[model samples]
Target: MTNHNYASRVQNHNSSIIADLLVQSSDPQNISFAGGYPDASLFPSADLADAFQHAVADNTPAVFQYTDAKGPQELRELVAARHAKHMGYPATADDIIMTQGGQQAIDLLASLFLDAGDGLAIEGPTYLGAISIFENYAPKYYEIPIETDGINLAILEQQLQANRGADRIKLLYLVPDFQNPTGITISVAKRQRLAELAETYDFYIIEDAPYRELRYRGEHLPTLQSFDTHHRVIYVSSFSKILAPSLRIGYICASPTILTAVAGLKSAADIQSPNMTLDALTYYLNHYDIDAHIANMIPYYAKKRQTMIDALHKYMPSEVTFTEPEGGFFLWITAPASLDLNAFMYDVLIPKARIVYIPSQAQYIHGDVANSARLNFSAVAIEKIEPGIRLLAETFTNYLTNHPAE
Candidate 1:
């Protein structure tokens, strides 16, 4: 072994449970409900191909040149316009800083704010990707419980108040719209309360909105940033879900002061985002009706979402409870605390049922997760849903009956 004192962050770079599940599920023999990827068929490949040709054919030098550290200004302006149309927020391009993707936005924000042992707040069962990024920063996480309507505000207020004076919590990270793993959206009332709490407690709110554009049924709700009179909300959105993920384009809207720090961090990290990809995306946005494209894609995902919901209802045991997410690509399922999802998966699901799902233990920062899991319906085709879910339900039912421990 070499004698080198690696930074403590390297210690936590171990293989994650989610990563393991993804690897195992990659086997074609297993019917995987693990990945959160969008349906490949929905990508506008032909249109994007045409746009890329026109973008490169017209201006080679400009397209290949380095972009602004904060990303292409015109693309930021176009994102601002889209925000205006969908979110009713008139944030200027000055408030936006582009990043590699939403994941980079999170990492940049963490780098800008977090120091070792800094206090941060997050939902208990939150986005695994966010947890993966934030963990490396070594923040003291204040995990708040959540409900279907959204985060439990009473508990959140208690935590905020508890950490108020010298504790000085740095950021309250959240995925307010169609949150990952749980598929829960914060209500308007709770959203307002969050804004007020952030102002009162002197903490920033990282409002991640990757899946807001993928909503299928619910009425459009105002974002936390919209209610932030104190400018405490950092609004993040990504083109990964809405457009070509390979473009690796996403943006964050926050106060100029916060964005300045983020831009500096971005420059240090990557100097600038890809100019050619930004040009292609800009050309596509200018020439194409992306809203119309997403509109066309809705029914397909909506049908898939419903099929998963229906399959769960028809096949699952009575003790098995799950969320009926109106939109987005996930369905969160929970069983009794005694049921160990990982053990169940190894012993029953894979060997007998021949199905795989993302166990929720790794989804939490705290290590008490016993009976929760996440399933994705978007990647699997329409025909496979019934058989996979039916088999999974049967396996679970048989296991509960046969085994006495859980």
Candidate 2:
């Protein structure tokens, strides 16, 4: 009926693999765990309303106008301060480049550093958004396997050594803390090695740490950026997880040169982040203690995380194995190798049982198992978790019984 003339670069590019599932899961009747969505009810609406009002009153006409490409200086300083205070990462305000979201930071970094055919190593199963954005550039890839602890560094070393001179590999990208889809954090030892690998391989590490502060259990491991003696790690995080997702505010901390380049790239993409949001975020950060606010939300999510884990253990088939995440919204589940997870999710679960999950097919760059899914626990209500998870477990067990993994 219309023009299908998309650019050649976009031929293989698609909105994450879960896009369809997300759309289906959006139905009011469906118990969906398809999106990396934080609980909407938990947002500090009253606090933010006053914060925005204060920002608008304080800044007047300027608040309505455009902002700097690197975002509000106050907000940037706060981002840097949070890192330095929490993780002991040596990030300064000058090193910060704020973006529309952490996703934009990734895009800006990709544009600034990656060229066509340039090698960009990433965790085999990384953030879906990162894969979609990076695919547009068509950079050669080195997919490292992820372990319970984190990315397998041995494979990373082997890849780096093998591809040492072939291509202009500019960077290695990863979601180190409470990584998406899997909900696993990289180990402290791996953090040091990752920094070392960056130094030895002469490639930068893009540490996408959107959920670093969301930890409800276990010790907070040092970030990869903290281990970097040299300016090799470009650390990016967002307010989406803690404050609000709709704010569309995230900031990157790296070397001044690196951030300068990111700012330039960001400017080319979108002149700057929205002035209103930036001002509001600045006011919120200055006025409120975000850590205390985050702490308040933790008990709720902690209980929900346990709820889902318990439900999975009790109701799911023996053939299924699910992750026991310390914190974070997602839990990775692997079904028997025989079943097509999408078939189970789309045809069986969504239609029959009104349950949904993001299948593992897209998560794996290359892995043995395909019958796996990323189930999000935070979006569902505390009361709804058990019933929803029961439906998921029963449906899975029945699916396996009818069609064994033989």
- Top-scoring candidate (TM-score): 1
Q: Write model 1 residue lDDT over 1-406, tens digit each, in one string.
A: 1225866665555245766888878888899898888899999999999888978987688888876788778888998888877876778888888888898999999998899888888997898888889888988888888898999999888777676554558799999887898888899999999999888888899999988888789688988888988989998888888886888988889878889989989999999888777778889999999999998988999999999889999999987899988777898899877898978887788888778987877788875786999899988888999889999898888877876552
Q: What do the candidate models score in CA lDDT, each in turn? A: 0.85, 0.84
lDDT of 2 by residue, 1-406 (tens): 1236977767655563456767777888888888688999899999999999998999999988887899878888887888789867867789888888898988888988888889898886777788888888888878788999999988888888887675746799999887898998899999999899888889998999888888879988888988898999888888898888999988888889887788778888989988888988889889898989999999988999998888888888788898888888898987777777877777788778888887776776543346888888888777888999888888877877787656
lDDT of 1: 0.85
Give model 2's TM-score versus the native structure: 0.96
Candidate 2 Cα misplacement greater than 4 A, ranges: 1-4, 366-369
Candidates' TM-scores? 0.96, 0.96
